[model samples]
Each structure stands twice: as C-alpha cells, then as structure tokens.
Target: MRIISGKYAKRNLFTLKSQKTRPTSDKVKESLFNSLGQFFAGGQVLDLYGGSGALGIEAVSRGCDHAVLNDVSRAAVAIIKKNVALTKEADRFDVTNMPAKVALKVLAQKGRKFDLVFLDPPYAKQQMVKDMTAMKQLDLLNDGALVVAETDDQTDLPAIAGFDLLKEHHLGKTLVRFYRKAAE
Candidate 1:
C-alpha cells in the first residue's frame, strides 16, 4: 500500500501477509480523505486498529501534527514501525502493540485527545460502538473530533447520542462512516 496524498504521498507501505489484518484499499483511503477535507491544519490522530499504520500516517502526511498507531499483533506493530520509518518522520508517530481498548485507556490516562480517529478493526470482531462509547467516557476525543469507521457493508453503525453521522459511503463490500462528536 502507499500514502495517497500530502508530503508522504506515494510513499510505499508494507502490510502483513497474514489474514489477521485487512488493510484499507487505496481507493477507499483516497475517497475517505477527500471527504474529510483532504488535509488538516494541525491536530493529533489515533489509528486504533492501526495495522500497517496507513490511515494514521496518511493523516500526518496530510498535515495533522502527530499520530498514534495501535494494534494488538506484534507483526502488525512491526509493520507499522517500518512504515513510519519509511516516512522519515518517526518523531511524529507513536506505535503501540496492544488491544484497542487497552490502548485507549492508556492514552486517556495520559490525557491524550485526538482530532481524528480511524477504526478498522477486524470485521469478525467489530465493536465500534462499544469502543466509541469508551472513548467518549475517557474524554479521549476532542470536541467535534472526527471519527472514521471502516467495516463490512452488513454492519450498520448507528449514530450514538454524542456523535452525529457526517457521511456514509459504500465502496464495494466495504462501508465507511464518518462521525463528528458533538462540541460540548
């Protein structure tokens, strides 16, 4: 896979060959970024199910200040680190090898907050709503934070109380939903 735009545009990224991780396709990534304004002025990003760190890295390339990429697998973590190194901006990234929930709690403890978040957990074990709720409880999301969730078309993600659906699109079998947290 490769970064779609910004400073790191066209940079190559390696993905695990294992079936455990499903990397976002270039088409979806590009379209998603376009929908999110293509670039950021300055803000942090959280790639909760980071995989190869494509989503978070892309955000950084497009101008977000920093990114934290977290995944549960060692192989995925290694791939993320390699991809971050490829950008030659390793200082702008933080990689964690842990479950999504655990990583969220740790970030919350550090008073970390994000302006953007990418959630692409394994389709078989999707817990997006639960995770979003936890993020809300932990105050890990900045007011009006944007959240993008990629999942199978069969999955229907509802608009929770604190978040409003911004956009929803389907690219073949993949469904992408963008939500904006209420500015409280």
Candidate 2:
C-alpha cells in the first residue's frame, strides 16, 4: 500500500508477507484523512497494531511532528521500518516491536502523549473494548487527542471512557470511528 495524500502522497510503503497483518485499504485511509481535515500539523501520533505503518506515515507526511508505530509481530515492525525509510521519514518515526497494551504501558510510563492515535487490531481478537480499557488505565491518551479505530464493521466498539465519540464512518467492510479525549 501507499500514502494517499500529503507531502508523501503516492509514495510507496512496504508490507508484511505474513497473513497475520491486515493493512487498511486506500479508500478507508482516504476517508480517514478527509475526516481529519487539517488537524495533523505538528501533531504527535501513535499507531497501535500498525501493519505497514501506513496510517502513521500518512500522518507524518501530512505535517505531524512525529509518530510511534507499534505492532506485535516482528515482521510487521520490520516492514514499518522499511516503509519509513522508503518514505524518507525515518527521522519522523519510532518503531515499537510489541503488543498494543505493552507499548501503551511503556509509552505512558515515559509520559508520552500524542495528538492522534490509531488502533487497528486483529478483528478476530475482539480486542476493541479490552484495548480501550487498557489505554485508559495506562493514561496513554491526552486531553482532546483524537483516536481513530479501524475494525471490521461487525466488531463492537465500547463506550469511550475518557474520550467522547466524535464521528463514525463506514467504508464498505471497514468501520472507522473517531474519538476525542474529554476536557476536564
């Protein structure tokens, strides 16, 4: 897959050969960035369950200051690194070779905060609710940060705890939901 817009628009990104990783479709990514509008400038982003690092790289290409991509599989992480290098954005990204929850815990402990966060876990895991809960517990989210969750249309998304539902879009079989952290 490749970046659909921004400075890296039409740029190629590497992919994992394994069947375990599922990359987001171009149509879905297009709809996502469209919905995000011009909010990416100088933003810090976190991409959980990042497959090809498309989402994070797209954010950076659109002016996000930096991005952290996390995935459980070594192959996925390797592909993310390669993709970043291919896009000439290696300096704008960090690759975390670990599961979502573990990466969130580590980042949170380091007091890391992001302006945008993307989550696209394996649909078979039914991991939406559990992951959301873990994010809240680890305080990985920041006030007003936008979290985009891409899941199978059938996957149930939980009621966001510290965030408010901003919008939801359905792109064929993919469901993209946006949430913003609530202000105290």
Candidate 3:
C-alpha cells in the first residue's frame, strides 16, 4: 500500500502479488505505531518476514535510522530492494534473502542490535515466541526494545521471561500485540 506517516507519508510502495505474502494494511499499521506513540527518535528496525519491506520501510519513514528487511523468498527480497530504493535513501536499508533464523544469526554475528522489531509472519506460519527467544539468545535486541507482533486473531502469544506485554489491538481478523523487552 503506502506509508501512513513521516517523511514517506502517503508514498505508494511495491507489493508482491503472490498469495504467499500479506502486506500489513494501512489501518493496522497506523494503529500499531499509534500504540508506540507516533514517530520515533532514532533506532534500528527489523522485519524478518519482509513482505514488500513495507513494515521496515514504514519504520524508517517514522524516524528509525535503519532497517533490516529479510525474507526467505528471493522474489520478496527483490521487491524489498525496489521499495527501499523508492525511499531514495538506499543506505538506510539492508535487504537479505534467507530463512528468518539464518538472518537473525547473521545479524547477531555482525553485532547488530535493534531497538524495534516487527514480527508479522504469514498468518498460518506464526512463530513469534520462538522467534523472540532466538533473538534474545542471539543478543540482537537492545534493552527495552519494542517488539510488535501482528497475527491472526486466533493466535495468542504468551508472556516470555524477558518481555512484558505492553498492549493489544484487535482490528477485525488481525491482532497486533506489543511487548517491551525487560532491560538486562
């Protein structure tokens, strides 16, 4: 769709026409950022299931300094590159085509730490808890980082040790959950 706010507000983006990926809707994206307060100061963002790179790009638009958009599909990664290029600040983005776990490990090896993370896997393939645990173990999250999880309403994410449930928003069939990592 398009960016809802910030520098790229209302800018149209590219999306995959495949049924394999679902882009977050503008309404849900708005509500999601609203819960975190409008724009951010500066931070790193990660979208492991980078469908069209929309979520990560949106975060950059809303003040995050950098974003890493990773997808298992090369096609999605290509679209992610195209969308990031549209920002005209290509240096702000890093696109990788790999399995989510591999990307996480690679980022960890590179000593990357993120302030914001978006976990919006395919509705039926959600593994948020496991993913969060991996991130925690990989030391990829900054203290007090925020993790936004978008899933089908049927998916209920439980409380993990290092994170506190911040809020939840139910928008029709979709459920968005926010969690803050406990400072170590």
Q: Which one wins on lDDT?
A: 1
Q: Write the per-residue lDDT of candidate 1 for residues 48-161, one digit (tens) a residue.
A: 999999999999999999999999999999999999999998999999998888999999999999999999988532488888888999999998899899998998766676
The better-scoring model by TM-score among 1 and 3 is: 1
Q: Model 2 reaches what TM-score against the true structure?
A: 0.93
lDDT tens digits by residue: candidate 3, 84-128: 988999999999999988999999999999999999876433478
In order of appearance, the predictions have TM-scores of 0.97, 0.93, 0.96
Model 3's TM-score against the true structure = 0.96
Instruction: Estimate candidate 3's RMSD in Å.
Output: 1.3
Q: List the residue pairs that clash in candidate 1.
A: none
Give each model's whole-structure lDDT: 0.92, 0.84, 0.89
Span of ten consecutive residues with least summed lDDT in model 1:
121-130
lDDT of 1: 0.92
* Sort order, lDDT high to low: 1, 3, 2
